[model samples]
Each structure stands twice: as structure tokens, then as C-alpha cells.
Target: MTPLHRVGSALAIAVALSLVTACTAPAPTPSPTPTIDDSAANTPPPTPAESVAPAGGSDPTCETIIPAATVEDFESLGWSAEQDDFRVGATIIDGGLQCVWADHAGPATDHVQIFGWAPIEQDAAYDAQDNLVGEGWVREDQPDGVYITENPETTISTDENGYGMTYLFGDGWVKVADTKQGLLLVVWGD
Candidate 1:
């Protein structure tokens, strides 16, 4: 072939080879997408602070309200007793004892609260129960007394961490207990 014909033939062969290589070449593999973790997002938010009533009534000593043996048991478990003015929700107990046992170094959920008062009139106790029911508490009448609680299934147990109010009302006495939060109120007298 002539020099020009040779060049033309070489160019045509090179172009054909390039086209075939491009059409037959394997495509590049794609990288994997990163995963987003959202495990913490599913957790429930912390409970908001409840409205507290103004401090009133007699502030009894923790030792007086909690028996010596119970106090010793709490001490043995590394828990301390705290006493303060008696109040429940937005109501103040005029002459009552507020006692708490918990580990001060631990979280606030680790606590047992108690409030006790005697000579509470039946009408006043019922009135208190009505007020609590108005505020979303559930009431159940027992054979000996009335039981009011924020969550009826949640009881005051030393072995469990619980949240909500548990109040027991007798003919002339009221006792309140809050396991998670250390506060209670007892209504006494007329």
C-alpha cells in the first residue's frame, strides 16, 4: 500500500480497537453509603418538675417518723434520712412529718418518701382525694381506707425504682409515699 493508505488504515484500526475496548470494559463498583445511628433519639425525655406548695406545717425529724430498725436498715444500705416541711403537690399538711431515705450520692430516683399525720377528718380527707383526682390521680377504695395514686399499678417498694404518688387514707389518718421523688404530705385535724 502507499504511505498515505498505510496511515489511513492504521488510524481506522486504532479507532476500532478503542471503541471495542470501551464497549467491553467493566463498570467501576460504587462505594457503600454510610449508616446513621439514632439509638438515643428513641429514648423518652426526662419528666418535668411538678409544682410544689409553699412550705408550711410542722417539720418532724426523720428519726421520729422512721422507726429505729428501719433507719438502721437504710443506714446499712448506705442511705441517709432527710426531713422537711410536709407538703404534697400544691397542698400543705399543717401538722405532719415528711421523711425520706435515700443515697445522697446516687441519682434522685433512688429514694423513698413518707408522710404521716393523725386525726385527719373524713370530710377533709375526701376533699383532698377529690382534689387529687381532679389533678389526674386515680382513686380506689379499700376495705379499711381509700388509696389514691398517680399510677395505681405503681406501689412503694424498696427493691424497685418507681415514679408516682401512693396515698393511704384511714378514718383519722393520712399517709403518703413517693418512691422516686422524696416528698409527701399528710392532712391532719379538721
Candidate 2:
């Protein structure tokens, strides 16, 4: 009799739970997005903050730059001992002077052009004795203009016409930087 009563109680509880579950409804699912007619044809586009800049834009200084030249120095652009008829040379451009030299061709007149990197004070040129000859500087004290230590001093001055038009060598118009680096630095591409 006791066992039969216990089974009857369990059946009653189960029936009650089943009835409750059947009456309750499941929760509704959420919608993916809202549907609305914005009608914002007259509204202007939102302007982004000035801090957001375009791509590929970097600081100019970060663009593979060489140092500025200083006085009493030579920035050896294409340093070489000897090649062929085309030896190597150094150009010096400080405040008032511009000069360059090559093998068998001491510091001569201002170079027609120097296209590579040249930094002042940091770059050094040496005499035969390995003494400090010139430090890189745009405004050097070479008042005598460009001179090569060959048979005679080969020189070019601002006073000379067509100095910057015809390249003494290479492919650009022969120009010189105004009291600074050579023409290669001052001018850019076509």
C-alpha cells in the first residue's frame, strides 16, 4: 500500500509539470535589422576628423633623405679609387663655394651635377695624408669657386652663362644649387 501511494504521487507531479509546459509559449526570435525610410537626401556627408589623412602620405623628412651640407667639407657622392677614363670625384658646396675633384683631377670647378646622397659635417673628404679636407656644408668658404687640381684650375662661376643648362656630364641640365648642395638636390624629376 505504501509503495502504491508513492507511485501515485510521482505521476501526479509529472502530469502537473507537463500541463504547465504545454500552456507556456516559446520566446520570439529577434529581427536581423530594422526597416526604415531614412529620406536623408539633403543631409551632407559626415566630415571625418582632420587627423585621418590619406594613404601613402608620410612626413617629407622620412623620405630617404641625406643630411644638409655644412662648411669646410666634401661629401664624396660617388667615392671610387679608379674605374676607367671615368674616375671618381668629390663635390663641396658650402655657403659661397662649389667644387669637385676626381682621380688625376683634384678639386676642380663646381661639379656639373651630383645626383646621390651627400650630408654635411657627417661626410668627410681626406687629403693624400688622410687629413680632413672638407666637411659637408651647403655654405662653404670656397670663395674661389670650383677648382680641379689638374694642369690648370678648371673653374665655373655664376658669372659664366649656360653653366646650369648644359651638363658638363650626365643627362640633366647643368645646374648648381644656390649656395647649397649640387644641382641634383635642388631640382627634381621632369
Best by TM-score: 1
C-alpha local distance difference test of each model:
0.56, 0.28
Poorest 10 consecutive residues by lDDT, candidate 2: 79-88
Candidate 1 clash pair list: none
Error of 2 at 37 (Å): 61
Specify the highest-lDDT model's number: 1
- Once fitted onto the true fold, the runs of candidate 1 whose alpha carbons sit more than 4 angstroms away are 1-60, 105-119, 152-164, 179-190
Candidate 1: residue 38 lDDT (0-100): 21
TM-score of 1: 0.51
Model 1, span 104-161: residue lDDT tens: 7665663444544434667878788899888777787867477777754544352133
- Candidate 2: where is the Cα deviation over 4 Å? 1-114, 120-152, 156-190
Q: Write the per-residue lDDT of candidate 2 for residues 1-190, one digit (tens) a residue.
A: 5999989999999999998988886768885332211122123322333212234743212111111331112223332222112111343323212232222244443333222222223223223112212222112223322221211123333322222111111122122332122332322111
Reference-based lDDT, residue 150, model 2: 17
